[model samples]
Target: MRADHPLRAIRQLANESLAALQADFSALYSGMGRPLIPPERLLRAMLLQAFYSIRSERQLMERLDFDLLFRWFVGLGVDDPVWDHSTFSKNRDRLIEGDEAARFLSALLPQPRVKRLLSSEHFSVDGTLIEAWASMKSFKPEDGTGPGDPPTPGGRNADADFRSEKRSNETHASTTDPDARLYRKGPGMEAKLAFLSHALMENHSALLIDACGTRVSGHAERVAALAMIEAHADRSRSITLGADRGYDAADFVNERRSMNVRPHIAHNLTRAKGRSAIDGRTTRHAGYAASQRIRKRIEESFGWIKTVAGLERPMVRGVDHVGWGFTFAATAYNLVRLPKLMARVT
Candidate 1:
């Protein structure tokens, strides 16, 4: 593999970190049974899925069986038999249960060159809706149905009519994905069963430092953002957090200040209260202006993850699995960004 090759960079990144990753993987499993697929190989394969936008695990395995670049990156021998797709999924569940994706991101960040590019003090936070795999038909009444109730003629995939029904998270839930919720970004947009994927990104490189998925709700975005921010919040140093008008609530701004952090959140003049949570006092700084300008870069993460990484409508069913996919995608995004960033700096 030549140094200029794209997968070469990722291959190097994974290989260099293999020792640490192995230590982490050991804790997730006890070495007592038959030898299984190496966790590192599984992670590399998962990253390949993100890089190529493969929609399903079966498709990923199919590609790995024939694609030499993928096989090389995944450290698979040419004649190695690909694991069954079902077995691959089962192994992946173990990684998700152990939160390996988050740990992968953590391990990647301490690289000497990458550390210099990160801005710990200035960051932005935002959330986007992840369309759930479940369809509207799956969102049925939560109450027990009478035995006399007729089943839809076509079974689980049967067409459902919700046109006249006033469906809400309170009264109904998705039978296919219980963790997903009916949600809409705004009034005019149609709601879908979805989860909110939130990220805390450094303004310097626009790389995600932390991310998580949560049940969809009006306040879930704000709540998730605070949790992400608080995890990195340090009392010894003040950090500035930039956000859009959606984060302009008085409580959120006040909460940011209470943590000894500055809130550079864009003000919402359209609020019914006729006032903004952020005032000229905080916005007057040049740093605040820069934060507002740079914060929009965070959207690039969402755009790439949704379109390029095949997360537009996640195939997974639960919030935990969906979150695992999102976090891993974020790691993949950073990996893609790092090589280009290093080239420019050199």
Candidate 2:
């Protein structure tokens, strides 16, 4: 492998972060039973999946078996036997139960080099829909009065017609993944069974500071934005939050002011009689205009996440599992960008 390979820098960062969390990983397991795959190796492999866009654990395992660079990055030797793909499926619940993905992400930011690249005063927030693993046909009536299995032989994917049926989240739920909510992105878009994934990005560096997954709802984006900012924002100093027109509401704007955070929200002028929660007082500042321009950079993070990370349609089912994957992907995004950022500062 080349000395300047990107994975080498990523591996150094991952090693440092994982080393800091050694005790945390050890606490998640008991000494009584047979030893399993090390959590550190599993996490490194998961990062590789996000980095390379490998679609499945089976494929990841296959690549690990022969790819020298992958084996080296994962801390596996040439003579080591590759574990079965099912090992990932079996051990995933343990990692989720331990909250390892979120911990790993948190562990990255406090590093001396990374902390300097972060901004203390300006941020942006947004949400994206992660299509659930369940199919539309799995969305069934809550009362169990919906259509039953077809009598035709090999009826696994029998036709499901909703021409005359009225189905909604209140009246129906996906049997395969009950936590997924039926949501539409906007007017004229087809509704899908999905969960909302929100990210909080600091405007100065365009690096994600926090991320989470939630059951889709009308106010999920605004609610998540407030929660993330509250957790990460310094209470002693004022900050600025930039968001699109979707977050321009009286309640949300008021909440930000209550926390001493300036609301750099875009005016939703198309509302009734041109009502807008943001007025000239907040918009008159030169920083507000700069924020609007920088805020769009958050979309680059989302684009890489959905396209390069293969999370546009997550393979996981429940919200917890989905959130775990989302947070881990965010960590990978930072790692991929950090090497270049650090080099410039040096």
Candidate 3:
């Protein structure tokens, strides 16, 4: 690969970040077991999956076997044998179980080189639904009893008629992934089993400062936003939080104010009988308009995550697994954008 190729920057960033996380990786594995795939290589492979939109571990391994660029990026020699896809997956689950994904993301921004690009006092938060791997057909009643029989019985793809039969998260659950909840993005949108993924982006550089995935709920967006903001907020110095109208709630605004964070949420004139929680006092500021404008850039991160990173419909099942993928994707998004940002800074 050329010196100016994007992966060169990404690989440098990954190397620096992984070097800082060596101890954590060591702690995750036992010294006695037959040597497993190095956690660093596994993480590099995961990053490649996000970078190239490789859909599955099997396909990823196939590329790693023959693609010299991938081999170089992953620190594998040309003649080294690739691990079986199943073995790669099993080791990946171990990393997820050890919370290495979140740790890796946390290790990135604190680097002196990257820290300068962050905005300490201005940020944006948003959430999108991550469709669960489970199918709606698996959403059966919790009681184990449902409408008589499938249209095509004794087969895995049997048709289920949900017409006129009331179904809800309260009385039903997905057998495939019990943690998933049925959710609709809008009034007329089709509902699907999904988890809500939230990202907190610093306005100055439009880099994701924090991210998480949570069970879908009516208030999950606001709740997750508050949690992430609290984690990053400085109580002595007030910060500004930009969000869409979905975050315009009285309680959420009050909570932000209590934390010395200004809620620069867009006015939801249609909500609460046209009474927006955000009043003229908050919107009158010049900074509020600026935040509103900068906040949209966060969508670029989300677009890359879903479309480029191939997480629009996550392959993972449970909330923990989904959260791992979401956070790792955030890190990958940062890596992809950082090269240009650093070049411009230099």
Candidate 4:
């Protein structure tokens, strides 16, 4: 009974990973009184909760209050009442919106010279539509009370005298989830007011270094991948980037070339599949073609976010909030991932 406990093991892992991140580099929310909960524990719990898809701060708070392992992961004792869930939704933006996770993901996955056996640095970049939590339902064609106001005499029908009408992104400014826009990237008519999330993780380490939340289509995937490159701020010839067909655009290739990094991007050969051949970009050059082979690794990053960070869709409304949310999830991902990576190196 006197020996080290299960919770102790979990706490050690959580704190180690947290220590890898830099929450202080942020210049956003300063002088916000004394911190009530330890930043590391609070951040880790958010990561765990997001990964499990558990919604609401109250739910997270309840779990932490009850789960001994979770308490330990955050370094709270069995008797400690973890901070309430609202703390996450409230304070998280300040910590995550900027350099928090990237600072840590970067520190944990720095490139090593003569470390020829590692595969984590070989990254694949891809992006997906994180369906917005808001609704086009708010985009009514007729006037109505702004959220909680009340029905104006009669906006019940289109024929009625109305001050406003439900307008799609094709028109009027939205009073709800205004930052979201209708986006359809799927094969069919399906679309969403989506925010895009992109990640760059070490293939072997599974440690994510850079991530971005954006709404611009056509180029969003490549833009995010480029952001990762820029964040690393590396122009060294040793780094090679991977990405799917979405990034097969000429600009991406030129951009990578300008940076002195190799682009192993897949060829967008959808039109020539049966008409032409199986391989596209990878077939063009020995290195380009070979580089494209590993772009699939980036998909694993998003998989971890939705699977482990509870962010298949954001809980918040605006693009800014969704961006913040993705950052939190990314930070959470690192918190969970760092421990396992350390275990390997140790």
Candidate 5:
């Protein structure tokens, strides 16, 4: 394997940061018991799965057994015995419960180089739906009554009738993943069980500085965007926020201004009979146009996370688990981009 492989740089960075989380790992495992598979190694393996689009833990372990590149990225030697897929799954559940993935991303932001590259003034926000693992049949009343039964001996979901049912989050819930809500992005689109993922990306480097996942709802995007932008911005300084027409709300714009942040949200003018929340006062600035141009870059991050990382329909069920996966995927996107940015600086 080449020494200068792109992943080798990621491995070096992972090792440096993993070492710092030693104490956090210690708390997850008792000192007296048989030593568990190292949390750091488990996380590294997960990163490999995200990077290479490995479908499952079993498949990842299988690759680690023989593939030199997979072993190298995961810090396993040629003769090292790979953990059983079930054990890896159990350990991952523990890690997810502890929210390590989100914390790992948090740790990365404070690093000197990453902090320097981050643009504190100009940022963009957007959200996408992460289709849940559940099926339409699983969405039923919280009282245990479902739409209909599936015929046996016809494979899974053979005869379930989910059509002609008016299901809403208020009246129905997914038995498999209660946190997932039935949502559709627009008219004529089929509603599916899904969660909302939001990202706050800086304009200069188009790097994701913050991200979050939430239960799908109409106002969730605007609510999450405001919270993430506020958290990322310096309170003393006025920052500019770029967003899509979905964020063009009077209340959201007013709130951004109250925080001393300029709302450069895209205007949502309707030809029929609606005025935009944003006026020429904000849109007249040249920076507003520049912010609009850079804001679309956030979609690149989303596209990679969904297609490359296979987060379009996560196997895990639950808001926290889904959120952690989204957060880790965002972190992986940054890791891939950071190496290139660092090389340019040198």
Candidate 6:
């Protein structure tokens, strides 16, 4: 509450972000349970812990009990009781993914009289690897033991074809985690089993319209990119899909075009030259080049999700739970973005 205190800024940011989420979530979450804790307060506290790297549920609880701003964000007045961290983790499971976060984001899409930062038409697409909650060590593949068996103990590094070896973290490994898999940009390298998170960002305002995380591909960048076409399909039927070199595959390009979407994916020099190229004839599209240039900025949104927002590794096991965590993180990120989005508005 002290104006001079450093945490005041944190509290204000946390409060505003939570307030936005509260409005979107209130009606839908009503029957999920009594507002066990004010969703805004609890969510803001979670965001603070993540952004500040507080780490672990216990640490978040301790801070809430002692820190004033945290207390305020979690809706605890001086005399009110603070909810336990477990209460949060418990109710959080009820939060939805796939559609829930998207719906909340849709609600906050725009305010009256506010012009959008990025025009719906001027958007870019990209994806990033989110290391799962499992470790390569614990994920050793099962030796042909069964159809969906775990990797054998010592054989964790067996296949150069698997994506687990390259993407798994060696520097700061997690103890409670056993499901993490390694992944890399290239194939035949199983570094970490990862979730591919694709995001579609409106360039000028950097608002994210859609995001989908998957566990199947090492190349989620291209996979989640189908989103651009799907979302834009009903709007105009014909749209430009911009992306990086990873999306320079024949099938991916063909797939986008078939949907009536123009593929503005960057040309991969290595593949663009030889006999492997998409025929020099078909490679000539100006819009494609322009789209490639703007694709880098798209990475910003995902960067914020992984680093600034602390979603690099999922919070829970199974793709579904991890997906749930990402939805909340994305919702939180948009809340942080709302002020910037509305800043220039009259």
State, as a TM-score between 0 and 1, how close model 5 is to the true structure. Answer: 0.95
TM-score leaderboard ranking? 2, 3, 1, 5, 4, 6
Once model 6 is optimally superposed onto the true structure by TM-score, how far is the C-alpha of residue 236 displaced, in angstroms?
4.3
After superposition of all CA atoms, the RMSD between model 5 and the true structure is 1.8
- Residue pairs with colliding backbones in model 3 are none
Cα lDDT tens digits for candidate 3, 206-285 = 99978899999999999899889998778898899999999999999999999999999999888657998998879999
**Full-model lDDT, candidate 2:** 0.91
Off by over 4 Å in 2: none
* TM-score on alpha carbons, each prediction: 0.95, 0.98, 0.97, 0.75, 0.95, 0.73
Report the C-alpha lDDT of model 1 over 221-289, residue by residue, as the tens digit: 899989989977898889999999999988888998999889999988887866998888898899999
lDDT of 4 by residue, 97-162 (tens): 554555544443443320222453355567777888876554543244334435555555223323
List per-prediction Cα lDDT, in the order shown. 0.88, 0.91, 0.91, 0.61, 0.87, 0.61
Residue 170, candidate 5: C-alpha displacement in angstroms: 1.5
Instruction: Report how far residue 31 has shifted in candidate 4, in Å.
Output: 6.4
The lDDT of model 3 is 0.91
Q: How many residue pairs clash in all the candidates, one count each?
A: 0, 0, 0, 15, 0, 35
Model 5 stretches astray by more than 4 angstroms: 32-34, 145-151, 154-156
- Looking at model 1, report the run of 10 residues with the lowest lDDT sum: 144-153
Q: What is the lDDT of residue 170 in candidate 1?
A: 87
- Which digits, one per residue and each the tens of the lDDT, describe model 2 over residues 126-160? 88889999998899989998879676675457777
